[model samples]
Target: MNFIPQFTQRSAGTEAVVSLPHGGRRPGRELLVRALIGLAILLVITLLVWFDRDAYSDSGGDGLTFVDALYYATVTASTTGYGDITPVTPGARLINALVITPMRIAFLVLLVGTTLEVLSNEVRRVLIDRRWRKRMRNHVVIVGYGVKGRSAVNTLHQQGHDLNRMVVIDNRPASVDEANLTGVAAIHGDATRREVLRRAEISKAREVIVTLDRDDSAILVTLTVRQLNPSAHIVVGGREGENVSLLRQSGADAVVTSSDAVGRLLGLSAVSPNIGAAIEDILSSGVGLEVAERQVTANEVGNSPADIRGERVVAVVRNKTMRRFYDQSVDTLQTGDNVVVIRKSEARAEKERSERD
Candidate 1:
């Protein structure tokens, strides 16, 4: 399915702009500015004609009053030319031809220009939306753009994930604008709705990340997404451990319970700060140390886990099954074994050294 992302509001560069459906907010401001300027011009001309009342003839009434000048200005600018008021003197005729006539034309142009600009913008928005949706496929759909969602996307970006292939769905206008600013496609709507998921092309998505603020909302979103795309990998974040089971039953492939994970970290910190620190270093990206996985080296293929050098080998994978270093079968590494190790993250090596000093 193609993902047609509608841009409700987006800020462009240095300008603070807010666009909306049908007619944008910023364009309305522009129209207001134009209207004010046109009114100012009309006022100035009305004063000029009123001050020189002797230069004109009002056949139906006495010499022109302030009210007549106002009425004449309106009818003249609108090209009504009622003919009751005529410029009898050469000075009045010259002023009407040189000054008043031009301002009248300008007033009409500004009104017509505003209409044309709106039409032009609508066409442009539609074309760009169509083009974006056509190229979307096998992308990643993020249901929320909150703290956890930002972290997840940042980590994926560090791993060289494509931002263009990711779509962010958030109900908050600010969140959607932020996502667009960061060069990601975003949809501003409730993600739990089936139509919204379909617009995000959930059927063709490779993965879906649910990080809503509430567990109940997350569960509803997970169930909806799973029903839409059963084959896609869905990773959900639950604030409480008790909600993890519900999220799993809702069809989330993996559920990360933030409360439980943080509690465990706190417990480990109280017992052994060094162990907790080490675990944190491994979990952190582009910092101190990191956990990485690699295929067994040629020379290390026939060697035992204890014989490997440089990095600490934590586990080995063979035939899709994981075996820890303490496991009997993992003592001997095989040809196709993949090793998971704790090593200094090469990407953050320089930054880490600088910060330590």
Candidate 2:
């Protein structure tokens, strides 16, 4: 099914910018700058004609004064030559032909350019949005851009995920601005609302991360997203461990207890520093060690997990069910199975390539 995103204003008052399309100047500011430039052009003409007042005549049968010079400049630059004031000298006429004409042309171009930009702004945004939407399948939708959301994005980025495939939704304008500054699309609205989720294309997203500050909000957003996209993998962050099951039952594929995780790590660090540090290193992405999942290769099929070189197989996933390496159901590697392994982040591919060679 093809869905086209339309950014319609839902309010009666001044609307906030929907998207920072090109991250360039605001339309109002751009028009103001162009107007200033047009005025500068007019000022130059006025000064030029004023300095050469001797070479000009006025319709009142008097010498050309500063007011007459200004009047002539206004009419001439606008291409509305009233002929009330005429340049009589050969030098003045030459200056008009060479300098004034070009300035007049430049002024017209600026005027036309400003009009075109204003007229084409909507069209440009629509075209860009169409193109972006067409390529946005299986993208990630982040419900919040707070600390957890930012850390999830940073971790994904470290694991070589494309930042362009991410979209952030935040109720705070500051979070939206910060998200845009990172080159990712952001929508400013309540993520728990269905309309806001539709704007983020949540139905087509492969993964939805709900990291709202409140656990109840996260559960609500998670439920809403699951209703919109049942197939998407939803990971939620809960403030307390007691609400973890509630978040999961709300259709989250995984739930992490923020306080419990931190508390356990701190306690482990006090008891066994080295083991705690190692666990932290593995949890932190793109570092000394990493945990990742991959499909079992043909060569590894029918062999024992210990025979696989370079990677330590921790679990085998079959039919979406995970089994530890010591499980009897997965003693022998199978063709259509995925293996979760722990390996050196920097040398993961190098070790596998060496094994193949």
Candidate 3:
């Protein structure tokens, strides 16, 4: 067997030798300074012990040693009085009072400084992460930080989308801070401006979501984003019964009206509450079931919904009837049938991953 030196073996066993040099080097330096200060305090106690030993012994009947003085200083700094060691002479008491007061003040200062440094480091880490996330490209930029925008961001994040790749552009500083706290890259800027859109990496973004409450702002943002990046997939939110044809004409790929969707949901609930509950469960991200529309190519499945890449097909909206496509043996998937696939969000994510790759 090869001979390994004891120092080398101990170094490998503890791993401390490798880490000791770099372990909180700054804190170590501070600790070293404190240790030197403590040593100087002990040296002062030694000098005082030599000078005041006779005076202390005259009152206590036992000579005051260097260790006794050092112990007294430590106890006074920590605010833990043992009552066993008492200074009797006026000179000794005066010395104790002078040294103990400064030691207590120094201890308090050190404690506050250390606490503030720890908090400062944590804040710096969060700020750095926020800055790094803002600089990333190919992100899905959400133009608003309202309820709709927040809901969309939460859904995407819960679906395991990278928060760094999902940038939030809001006008309010509070909204930006909220998004940043959630690890979502957020910048405070007007979405209607081309410069603001550029700052959000509009040209490089894969998707742009406009969820502003103001219809005019939404329309203007849509137009601007389309003009800036014609190829980006733009999704806009509109009010109830609001004509989004102009928005679509302006180049939004999809327009979602919350008023219309909510009205429809309420109507469905009035008719069949269980069905509405099921629909809500499917739509809710927490339920893990997503009602996703998958486009079938002519060459891929030969127009067959049964051949789609999922476990179950809930319904096929063909001829606008919402017929059951679960057990249907249709040979061809018609061009217009929006295949409603009810499956786990993970499955949809996997499908998206495959398509992207």
The best candidate by TM-score is 2
Q: CA lDDT of each candidate?
A: 0.82, 0.82, 0.69
The number of the candidate with the highest lDDT is 2
What is the TM-score (0 to 1) of candidate 1?
0.77
Tell me the tens digit of each residue's lDDT in model 2 across 1-357. 122222323243533224432345556677799999999999899999999988888889978888888889889988999898989999999999999999999999998888887667668666655566677889998888999989988877766778788888888867876776666677778888887888778899999988988998998999999999999999998999999989989999999899999999999999999989999998876567889899999999999887889889999999999999999899899899999998888555566679999
The alpha-carbon deviation from the true structure for residue 79 of candidate 1, after best TM-score superposition, in angstroms, is 3.9
Give the residue spans of candidate 1 off by over 4 A. Answer: 1-6, 9-95, 292-341, 350-357
Better TM-score candidate (2, 3): 2
> Candidate 1, residues 1-357: lDDT per residue as tens digits?
233334343332221111212222455577789889889878978997998889999987688999999889989988898989988899999999999999999988987887898788777666666566677788899889888888888877776788878988888877876776666777777888787787787888999999998999999999999999999999998999988889999999999998899899999989999989988887799887878788998999889988988889999999978899999988899999999988878787777679999
Off by over 4 Å in 2: 1-33, 53-72, 81-90, 158-160, 171-183, 303-307, 326-328, 347-357
Lowest-sum lDDT 10-residue window in model 3: 15-24
Estimate candidate 1's RMSD in Å.
6.0
Off by over 4 Å in 3: 1-135, 293-303, 307-310, 314-340, 344-357
Candidate 3 structure quality by residue, lDDT tens digits, 1-357: 111111101222221110001112444466577667766665665566556766553235576677776776566566686766666788878877787567667775776776787677556545544454356667798989889999999987776677757878887766765665566666566788776677666888888999999878888999999999988999999884556888788889999988989999999999999878988988887455686656555664455666666545666676755667754644466776666787777755677789999
